[model samples]
Target: MKQFYLSLIAFFTWVIGMAQSGGDSTRLPLTDSIQAKKSTFTIGAVYANDASYYGQRSDERLPYVALAAAYHHRSGFYLTGMGYRLLNDSARLASAYSLGAGFSFPLGKSFTADLSYDYSIYPKFSPFLQAANPHSVNLTIARESVVDLSISGDYAFGKTNDFFITPQISRDIDLFNIGRNDLVSFNPSLDMTAGTQHFYEYYQEEKGIRDSILGILMPPVLGGSPSEQNPTIKTTNRFEILSYNLKLPVSYNRNHLKLEVSGQFSLLSKQAQSQPGKVNSFFSAAFYYQF
Candidate 1:
């Protein structure tokens, strides 16, 4: 992992150096149609502090750096996935990730809708373990003009049968002169989520945490004497607002390539706020290209 990260740093340094010298980074993979269709192939690296994306705490807190690849077409179809190396918490390169494929289409004058299925796979100790679900179908609709408005739904298929809905709004502003022919912009957005009780069940350690190691991290929450008839009841769980977050993303674009850097400041609602050692902010850096 250390060597891989060092290599990645070198790769980015070289790319940026060439771009600054007015050199081209095109790979010669496509022709005029690729440029006209706005077909893009992208790879990026992300540094995230929020290990507990489900809004829960663990005994250990570790930041993660992930590598991601994605492809998009002007026709509104995309495929994307991430591979992560867990830092401090574990020493695995492919510890956790989600892969998604989807299609998008215009709904009306300014509205567009997307449909996709996300497959989340976590091998090591991660928040997704308790839910017993890995498959989720996501749907999103939004407008991307002067102001952006989007709503999304995610339904997990598993024993937990969890579902969540999120609504968001955003705006973009032009930044100061970055490069003469390059574009710079900053996007700020806010979003809120409401979800089913099953999604939050990871918080209830007594009922969840089937793995012995995970049980140690969370600790059993339920208590009963030797004479107790039932240890834990299924009806004790309830649902509330899942989370809300404010995100700021800035980007620079030149030619058919763009480099983006962003920060996500998040706030959890209801029982989700009680997490300890949980980092509420995540940062990312990405480079994208078309044609």
Candidate 2:
């Protein structure tokens, strides 16, 4: 059961990462050449069936909808904002919001780099797991070729600090063309993630209030002591391989609008264990429009 809760937390963290990276783990969408001539503004909306990080998946259906807006200058500087609303059994109309700024630029003929910072805001009693870490810095370096290759590093801090690294290889396949200006394509990527689990420790400590309520509903004798109710899940500060993930995204591009449906499967490592070697799957749909 504790592992189940941890899985829920991991899912939220993964979703936050996906949003921050412009729906792709390896590249920055805001830096495309289309926006190089002038500043561009984009608006997007997303819906996900469930959330997963690495191979850890939420036991319950934690569906959510999010709206985002971004501004990208021709010089490769950008600003973004997003708001989330959980469509679960919660009274809160708003779940969280994030504000971010970043810069993206080419390194050489084939390499590009992006650097960004994000700050997240959550309610005091927010149920989301990532509330523990409100600030993060991200850097990604990519090499364009027959197969796109990239590596990303993230450092998140607030109640606790955690670091993660992901290296990925991917290819984009154009399935067909729609008229002269539109097309459909499939993008497939494989990535491995390694990270520390300090945020899990913070989450464990923060569960006291909820556990207290549970204790009141069910007495200590039946529910056990607070310590027993919330037994410490030992975590190591050392970095460990969390999960290996494969992602497939199908996208339709028409004029200034893009629609995408994506799916991912993750195989968990020993470090992400409720059960060792777990597998999790997730799905989402999103649309973005630029002006």
Q: Cα lDDT of all candidates, in order?
A: 0.60, 0.73
Per-residue CA lDDT of candidate 1, range 1-291, in tens?
A: 355346435643543333322232222121112224577776666676646454443334556787877777878677888887767644565667788888877788878788888787865335443335678898988775555689998887664676778888766556555677776766666776676555334434423344455454322334544224233324324445656666778877677676777887656553442442233676766665554
Candidate 2 residues 68-125, lDDT tens each?
Answer: 8899988888899999888973777778899999988889998989999999997764
Alpha carbon RMSD to native, model 1: 11.0
lDDT comparing candidate 1 with the true structure:
0.60
Error of 1 at 202 (Å): 4.7
Query: TM-score of the candidate numbered 1?
Result: 0.71
Report how far residue 206 has shifted in candidate 1, in Å: 9.9
Question: Against the true structure, what is every candidate's RMSD?
Answer: 11.0, 7.6
Model 2 regions lying over 4 Å from their true place: 1-35, 214-232, 273-276
Residue pairs clashing, model 2 = none
lDDT of 1 at 247: 72
How good is model 2 by TM-score? 0.82
- Name the runs in model 1 displaced over 4 angstroms: 1-36, 52-59, 124-131, 202-239, 273-279
